[model samples]
Structures are given as C-alpha cells and as structure tokens.
Target: MIESDIKRYELLLDLLQKSKKEQDEQNNTLDQKCSSMINILILIITIQCGIYANVALLNEIASSEIAIIIKVLLIITLIGNFIALYFFIAAYYLKDFEGMTNEEDIIKYGENNTNLETIYKEISVDYKRTIEENKIELSKIDKIKLGFKIVTLTTGIFVLTIIICLEILI
Candidate 1:
C-alpha cells in the first residue's frame, strides 16, 4: 500500500508539471499575439495619418459635409487604435512568475527529512503553489484578446472610411 501511494504521488507531480508547461506555452503565445497586434495598429495609424494629410490638401474637403464625416471617422479610428495599443502594451508587461522548488532547497530538505512521504508532500505543495502563481500571470491573456478584438473592429471601420474618401476624391 505504501509503494502504491508513493507511485500515485509521483504521478500527480508529473501531471502538475505538465499543466505548468502548458500554461507557459499559452503565456508565450499570448505575448506573441500582443506584439503582432501592436505592429498592426502602428501601421494602421500611420496610414490614417497619410490619408488625413492627403484629404486635408484637397480644397473641396474644407467645405463639404462628406469631408467632415470622413475627418470624424479618421479621428475615431486614430483614437481607437491608440486605445487598443495601450491595452497591448499593458498586456506585454512582464509578470514575475513563481518557479519550481530550487535544487538547493530540495537538497536541504532531503538532508534533514528522511521520510519519503514527507518530502513528496512538501514538493507537491510547492508545485501547486507555483502553478497557482502562474495562473495569476496568465490573467493578462484577456486584456490582449480584448485588444485584438478592438483592432479588428477598428480596422474594418478604417477600411470603410478610406473607401468613402477615395470615392469622393476620384
């Protein structure tokens, strides 16, 4: 019975380690998505600025209702993109994650505590603690996902605005 219990605890530890590894992979993917969204936003903002400049140069824009609407849409696009950019930057903030038990600590525990069950219990507790801490770090996933949604919606609006302005100019 004692041998089976030890084996069970070992299996539990392995499962916990696997879960932690999955969380780490997810965190890395979230970071990459955030970075890519930031780049897309920057590009969109730059293009909007160029379009605004070109539209401003048109003498008819100053006097037309359509011009006012286009300018308003452009302003909204800029503001939305900037807000999304802020979210991505916030999501990019590095989290200090708790790591697994250090080898030194394990060695120290081993020297003082000869009981196998006691050591396994302590290590399992440590692993669980780190996994919870990592879950906290992963909370930023929602913020980045929200930012991506915002960028997608705003980009669609921006495209429509550009099409309208182009039609008017031509």
Candidate 2:
C-alpha cells in the first residue's frame, strides 16, 4: 500500500511539473506576442506622425471635410491604441502562481528519514494547492490572450482607417 502511495505521489509531482512547464512556455509566447504588437504600434504611430509632418511642411492640407475626417480617424486610432496598451499593461502586471515544490526539497525530505505517510500527506496537500493555483493562472492567461486579440483587431482597424484617410488626403 505504501509503495503504491509513493508511486502515486511521484506521478502527481511529474504531472504538476509538466503542467507548470507548459504554462511557462505559454506565458513566454504571449509575452513575446504582446511585445511585438507594442513595437508594431509604435512603428505605425511614428510613420503616421511623419506623414502628417510632411504634409504640413508641404502645405498640402486637404479640404476642411477631409481634414475633419482625418482628425476623427486619428482620434479613433489613438483611443484604440490606448485601450490596447492598457490591457497589455494589466496582463503584464499579473503575478505568476507559486507554491510548487522543487526536486531538492523532495530529496531533502526523503533524506531526513521522514515517515512515508507524512511525506505522502505533504505531497498530496501540495499537489492540491498547486492544482488550484494553476487553475487561477490559466484563467488569467486566458484573459490576457483575449486582451491581445482585442488589441490586434483594434490595431488592424486603425491601420486600415489611417490608410483610407491618407488616400483621401492625397
């Protein structure tokens, strides 16, 4: 019975470790995507500013109606970018789950000549706690993913609108 219990604990620990590794990988991927989007946004804003400056320098202002349309488009782009940025920043601020045990700790516990039942109980508790923590982390990641999708969609719309406005001005 004790042997089977030990094996169960080991299996649980292995599964938890695998889950944590997968979560870490996903977090890194999402972080990279968010960073890439932010960079793209910056580039878009820079290009738009440059175009506006060139037009101003060349005294090529469009008709008042077109100018107003351009202004509205610019505002929409700015607001969308702002909302996206806010969500990205919120996602960045989320804390990662903690409370998982390391191999060293398990080894140390074993070396201490601890009772098998005690060790099993401790591992079981830790396993349960970690499972809960992982659930919460997964939920947060889902939210972050949703936020990133919103940002991507908003930025795309902004880019298309700006392109149309630029064509009108030209």
Models 1 onward score TM values of 0.86, 0.72
- lDDT (C-alpha) at residue 83 in model 1: 92
Give per-residue CA lDDT, model 2, range 54-96, as digits (tens).
4442234567665656656656666666666666666665656
Model 1 / residue 113 / CA error / Å: 5.7
Q: Which is the leading candidate under lDDT?
A: 1
Residues 1-170, candidate 1, lDDT per residue (tens digit)? 39998998898888888988898888788788888888888888898888878777555554577777888888888888999999998988767788898999889886886577777778888888998877845448677878878888888888998788677667
- Error of model 1, residue 110, in angstroms: 3.9
TM-score of 1: 0.86
Question: Model 1 lDDT vs. the true structure?
Answer: 0.81
Query: Number of clashing pairs, model 2?
Result: 0
Which has the greatest TM-score?
Answer: 1
